[model samples]
Target: MTQEFGSQSTTDEVLAGVNLHGKRVLVTGTSAGLGVETARALAAHSAHVLGTARDLAKARQATSSVLEAAKAGGGSFELAELDLASLASVRACADRLLAAGEGFDMVIANAGVMAAPFGHTQDGFETQFGTNHLGHFTFINRIAPLLSAGGRLVNLSSAGHRFADVDLDDPNFAQTPYDPWVAYGRSKTANILFAVEFDRRHRDRGVRATAVHPGGIRTELSRHMSQADEEALISTINATNAAAGLPPFTYKSIPQGAATSVWAAVVADGDAVGGHYCEDCHVAAVQDGEGLRGGVRPYALDAERAKALWVLSERLVGEQF
Candidate 1:
């Protein structure tokens, strides 16, 4: 059974009473926003956290801040290089980790770009699809060995996935007009599908995976959004929250936004049950409507689609496992 912690629950609250001494955690997109919160919370619990970012210098700065906070709270942290937009970078980062002979108790695939103007990664793939989905896909496969049995993997997905399915024929936007929201939706869907397939393939090995949608929070993640676009989204969210008699979509603080992820990683949920989509500090229920205003859409939970995407990903990344 899953429990719902409201938007008020902070990462520290979600992680309350859990002791993580000696646990090794790796969190991507750790330079800022919820990523930093995840890293900070983990480290604060005595977990040795390795945070990743695209820019080495920026990552160092961010790591320093997190480390300072961790130290203040009597915790520890480290930094690493990981650019989700570049497969080469992802592979290189994985190689570095492997070289260190370090084993991770958890790998939090939190790095991702949201709706951004049309662009491509260094690999010629569309930016959102490449960075949000493919890079993590390749990264996990590359470091699958370091994930000790019973290790956890968490993928950060979004409610925006209610918008679209993967366009297998044109995942890279090579033949079709690019819509940033649709691109983001596709990538987020890939995140969920990835966890489903990953759980299926690796659960027997005592490994498990989960996907999460942290409730909306204001953060630097909106940097790519236009002022108009941001205003529009905020209006829509506020309207929905108001209708629900909720607090006008103030939604979550950064620590709150990172709560569900921390909970999923450390909770003793009985033997690494995988392929679950979580939100608000618990596994979310599957919904069946199109244009789902809230909650996970059916398409995101479809087992068939999940498995199919796995095959497609394996083909794209050229990895046997």
Candidate 2:
């Protein structure tokens, strides 16, 4: 029987009775929070996991549990240095993987920053935009040849994307005022759009790409936010939920946050999620709204916009996919 999963499903629960003895998966941001949990769960299921982090030292210490799980479950776990804020680092990491030549069944772009202060990446693009979107864009495209024919690419996006759409004209916010939330939203939207176009480009080769919202989880992604900032965001969301006669907003557990990613990568039918946006372990409806209840925005999945963003991204990164 096909199992039913929901907002609170844990990684172990999602993988119940499913054996992944030889599947190879690449997950970014294994240093903490959802990334660590994601790697651990996959490793627990005997999936060979290649995890990346900006700081190998910190990721090694944080993912000691992943190593243990891998050992116990007859899987393997390895880590590599990847600083998404630096295109140099991203290319170097991709080059190393390409040189290794082992194919991956899935590439989970799960690393990201949220609501960070105004700044630029090593490439001079806005911090969130460059790190979250362009970095992965270049990194993943660079390693496209290594994606197994039936492989899937899952980008970790968020409901925070509701805050804004991509400003193709001024992605760097040179003339306009900068709001951390807006910048994050643009980056998250880019993640979904990137997945959309990527799926279109690679589906003929049996590779698919999709983006997912992991829901609200108290993870290191929120490190940039102050207590007041977090509380205020919660208050705003809860107020909207209350007005809509919905349950008060609550944060998902780290495992819950990681579940949808694994579900999209391995369990969900590839055709169902390809070029789509998901949340709560299912393909979310395209809903236009002010509240973060649980649906994708129309703009986030626009094909034309996805194509436009893809072109823009290539130009910015000085590479062609």
Candidate 3:
């Protein structure tokens, strides 16, 4: 039976009565913000959570609260080093997990960078695209076999996917000028597409993938934005809503923002939600328009595009399954 949850739901509230004992889950970016809360909540429910960060020392310090939460709930917490911006680091992390030969019940691709200044990853892909999409793409695929039967993959996408679809011809913007938000939107779109295609290829293997828009929350993901950037973002949001005849934007608290992810990862029925994008703790509608008010863009869920991206990503990462 499918349960109905909403935007106001908290992580604990949504996961209430769900016993995750003996379940092993992997969560990225658990040093702070949504990732930390996500790990905390799952661990609180007696799941063994392996959380990742770029720097192990910093992650240990930053995730002290997660440790406390896990202790309180009699759950296990372990930290791993993972830097999505570096392919070598991604491989190293995957190697460790693969060597362990243990499988995870769920893997949450929750780490990502937001609108940042133009830069390239160590491998020379655009920062946002590289770190957000390609990085996770490579990491997840490499570790995919480690996902146990009936496992779930929850990708953390964003509502910003409405900003722009990916430019397959020029993902790195070699010719086109770089617009931070546009790049972010494209990466987010890729996130959704990754889930769509991943589910298609792996669902028969009992692995299901879904993308999630965790809602707007004040978190470190926006640390790259300045005061002016925030105002401009708000202005763009209000303008978009006005065009859509929708209500003004309202930000969600951290717990509220994480509701949908937790829902997708643990509470929701995997088969029903797989390959779909979710927000407000529910499946988001596919709305093709010039507004970021709500819902996902149709292009983000296009199966053909997802397949095309999967091919392109394999070529770019120089690996295939």
CA lDDT scores, all candidates in order: 0.83, 0.95, 0.92
* lDDT, candidate 2, 12-69, per-residue tens: 9999987889999999999999999999999999999999999999999999999999
Clashing pairs in 1: none
lDDT of 3 by residue, 1-321 (tens): 356788788898898888898999999998879998999899898899999999788789888878888898878899999999999999999999999999999999999999989999999999999999999999999999999989999999999998899989999999989999999999999999999999999999889999999988999999999999898888899999888777788888888888888899888888889999999888898887786768899999999999999999999899996
Tell me the TM-score of model 2: 0.99
- Between the candidate structures 2 and 3, which one is better when assessed by lDDT? 2
What CA RMSD would candidate 2 show?
A: 0.8
Instruction: Tell me which residue pairs clash in candidate 3.
Output: none
- The regions of model 2 sitting more than 4 angstroms off are none
Candidate 2 Cα deviation (angstroms), residue 219: 0.9
- Tens-digit lDDT track of model 1 for 153-264: 9999998888798887788888888899899999999999898888887888888998988878788777889889988887877776576666665557889899888888
Best by TM-score: 2
Error of 2 at 163 (Å): 0.5
- Report lDDT (Cα) of residue 14, candidate 3: 91
Query: What CA RMSD would candidate 3 show?
Result: 1.1
